[model samples]
Target: MECPYWLTSSQVGVYGRAAPEDFTADYEHWKRVVAQSYLNGIGISWSSVRNVMDMRAVYGGFAAALRDLNVWVMNVVSIDSPDTLPIIYERGLFGIYHNWCESFNTYPRSYDLLHADHIFSKTKKKCNLVAVIAEADRILRPEGKLIVRDDVETLGQVENMLRSMHWEIRMTYSKEKEGLLCAQKTMWRPKEMEIIKSAIA
Candidate 1:
């Protein structure tokens, strides 16, 4: 699907908002943290990972890090901006996908690891956070890991939602208004069944 808005330039943007300065440093820091979390927190090795998806990939920094580890990576951006696409391409991120976070075009059980950085804060304004979480659950393989980084305001709510969905919280780090959480999908609940359960109760 095409992006809802056009981004004219690549000026340190994330979650449809422009950063005050270059986001390279932030991206690099998160990349290392995420990798370390997967290794130490989640207890998963790089060789065990086959495919990964970055749900709100801005300039593909995280994807690049995974690629360096020889893992197949897919980066999805919500916007269809002309300016950002070229920069993503320039970074040699050819596997980039475009779609809304709450709705994706990928097949079910398509990824081993899914990453979302500051996506909840952004999508909470436009779509149902539960829908986005459900979609993430739907696309991830059983036992797949979901790594999320978001502002502190929504951390508790996000954690509760994931727990309600049967995800196992692996690690969580929160300081002031920023946090990172990693959880693993341990079970599957079909969408139809979820609706039925909701309707019946």
Candidate 2:
């Protein structure tokens, strides 16, 4: 059995005159792809339930993947509301899913992989995939992985930053011109700290 892949999506759906049959078929195809990659687990976080409702025509694949892969699922939104964080925590998922967008601070030193699905894009000028990589490094265990897929203009910059940080570039690919990069976190030596202390003495 191969290791499963993790997936995250942003605003993926059909709307406005697309036939229901076509919509449903496309959604199923997306889900099957997600299911096949269910190794470490699976997660889906939407900006709103309404935003995801029309998208659900594609979610049968998600549900089927969850069933076949025994993967975990989560839903989140930007605004804090009743039963939001509590529900996510109750499910034992990576909790407070909305926090990923909270003004982009560095992550605390405690997580493993930081997975981003469709968060970055050429049209939308908001998300920073490199900051996300830094945050993942700050929080991940040594040799951990960061999985990201997005519409990026500078794949080389992402790869270069990871290498400068001593992270290993594991994989990269293109899907319809969108670049996906997979990098592994590596241990950072405290050589500078040691040298500074020795000089002071």
Candidate 3:
């Protein structure tokens, strides 16, 4: 299969091209941080994490790192194109699932931990931010954690939306144009509240 133009092209956009070695190194640093987050129960502990989803796993680096720690991981990409299949396979990323961020194919409460790296900034330009958050809320189990990294411009909006949903912000760090946040899903709302929300929708 031909590589997708987005992956192969030199045109700059939300996701710019990077040297493979540099990308790998960056991912490695994040992997350690995420692993520590889990181990330290930053939002939720490793013991609480049974299944994880890398919402925008490029080259499956984060997923691979979680797997090395004996965690069950499913790597998801926005596009289902064959462009990344060879790379996925080469990296031994066996648990791959494809779906757009705004809508996923997984069942409700499917994952204990969901990680997104620079995904919101890219998707927000193309999809509804509310839809993306709702989908993430649906798939995450109650008390499940979400770890996200994105540029400063998009991070504020994303943080506000998650806060509005009553998700507990567990940790946050920012440096220049980049930011990282971890949040945990709380209890379900009252049925009447859901009904009112549905009505509003």
Candidate 4:
């Protein structure tokens, strides 16, 4: 079923921020832009993907964007961001409040896909990014995909970290310092080994 382009937002004309219409248009544009990555670059197989998590969900737009797909999204709003969770609930969507610097409450391998929009740059000043990525690894299923959008420098840093983690870099593109990266988690782990020393005469 298709979701209506407009949603009921109590923050409208009251939050005194941007216009509600502007937010609607913005997220709609974001939805279209994200769809392109799926169509051409990352090539995510939605058939097997059932669980999705929007790590820095703003007004639950990413979840709205994928409404047609047979998947449910856990829209996670940052504690530092504005209070938009109420608006998300008003729109018939559910989500949780979280601080990415800390851990998200869930089991290991809980999600099939995790998407973050500029979250790394935002969190780097506040906490350790390695912890955030490690938490992501703990929750994402094996071979699950992760998509991130950030500045080019942050993208490069995260790409290198992911490579070290043995995650395959699926796609990366940077446009004027704005970048996007997609990677798939692997099952590789460090193996224990023993070495024997030989004495030479």
Candidate 5:
């Protein structure tokens, strides 16, 4: 079956002062973009819309802004534990989450079509993206598409990597979405112990 494009959000860390203006503008814009994307039959699905909704509900006014959208946006929270999966599945959704709190050697499996938002710009945090993309592909259903909105700037490398993994690059939008970079997750494989060890050695 063809994999669907899924939305993935990143974990919010204690970065610089919060930018409410940017956040609000982006949230409304994204709501429209997402709504339009889904309405156009682009195979788009939200990963953890609940989280975004909760965070932006009061501050970003998402409920009203996205009320007219027809996409199946589910209630979601950060997936810091495996237990979060059943909750999402109960909602009739196959969502994606990231686990970057580990070493490169301990990279986790990609949840097919994992949805992620706001990746780190620094190198240390940037390394986590591989795991994010890898896991998304790993757990994704056949021909699944992974969707992400991150702050990283290496689009070429990211696109190449996805293609190498057999994912078809459907479409990509730059910081136009308020520093929210979006990409599709296609065919991908979770790196095996043999492959990792071989590369390490």
Candidate 6:
């Protein structure tokens, strides 16, 4: 088979867009490394996690990177970002356009896992972050995992919100200004809600 010229380190494909440091010859390998490390840390069983979403997909590299995994990735390009949905389809992957400030058009607990790369920083300037966090809680399954990579400040704020929802903060790491947070959602109910249910019963 003939190799695509754009797959080389020097080219940005037909879109001619993507992070400059991204998509080197080792791009896919780097993603595989990241996926392996995080999955090992979280102890996710591939048998259970069938569907995944890349919330801030740029050039669909994250999806391309996970080709070896026994999972499917839905690349979501933020409406605020470049319109690269065409490129995603061109690569024979899946994708959609979305605005994080608004709720995604799907039922609750749709995704088994979510990879949010720098989504908070971009969405924060325009909308109430509480709404965004609530939406995340809505879309992820009860036992689903959320992997967020964002600036340290945003991660701090995000941790507080997720904690408030009773989601377990499984792991958190930061280097200088950037940060990573892994959390697992639970079906925990508030004490007040339980009391109300008891009274009704």
Model 1: worst 10 consecutive residues (lDDT sum) = 1-10
Candidate 2 residue-wise lDDT, 114-141, digit = tens: 4544443321244454554454455556
Worst 10 residues of 5 by lDDT: 51-60
Off by over 4 Å in 6: 1-22, 29-36, 107-109, 190-201
> Compared with the true structure, what per-residue lDDT tens digits does model 3 show for residues 1-201?
222334433433223454354345545765787567545645456776888888877666676666646577777766643344445566666545554543566754388898988778877776676677777887898899998889987878888988888899998888988988889889954355442242124
- lDDT (CA) for every model shown? 0.69, 0.44, 0.69, 0.78, 0.41, 0.77
The top-ranked prediction according to lDDT is 4
Q: Least accurate stretch of 10 residues (summed lDDT) in model 2?
A: 48-57
Q: For model 3, which pairs clash?
A: none
What digit string (tens of lDDT, one per residue) describes model 6 on residues 135-193?
Answer: 78878889999989999999999999999999999889999899889999999856763
TM-score of 6: 0.80
Where does candidate 5 stray beyond 4 Å? 1-27, 41-98, 101-113, 120-128, 175-194, 197-201
Task: Report the C-alpha lDDT of model 1 over 1-201, residue by residue, as the tens digit.
Answer: 112234334543654445423345445765787577655675565677788988777666676666557787777766643344455566667555554533576764489898888777877776667777777787888888888889977767789988988889988888877998888889656465545232122
- Model 1 residue runs over 4 Å out of place are 1-27, 34-38, 80-83, 95-102, 188-192, 196-201
Query: On residues 1-201, what C-alpha lDDT tens digit does candidate 5 reach at each position?
Result: 111123122322122223333334545665785566633545545442222212111122233345454433322233343233333443344343433433222133322333444432322253454554453444455554545554446454566667777777777766543333234544345475424332223
The per-prediction tally of clashing pairs is 2, 4, 0, 0, 18, 0
lDDT per residue for candidate 4 within 33-145, as digits (tens), equals 76876645687888989999999887777887787788888999899988778767766777999988766778543999999888899988887777777778878989999
Q: Estimate each model's TM-score.
A: 0.76, 0.50, 0.76, 0.84, 0.46, 0.80
Looking at model 6, the pairs that clash are none
- Between the candidate structures 2 and 4, which one is better when assessed by lDDT? 4
| Runs off by more than 4 Å, candidate 4 | 1-17, 191-201
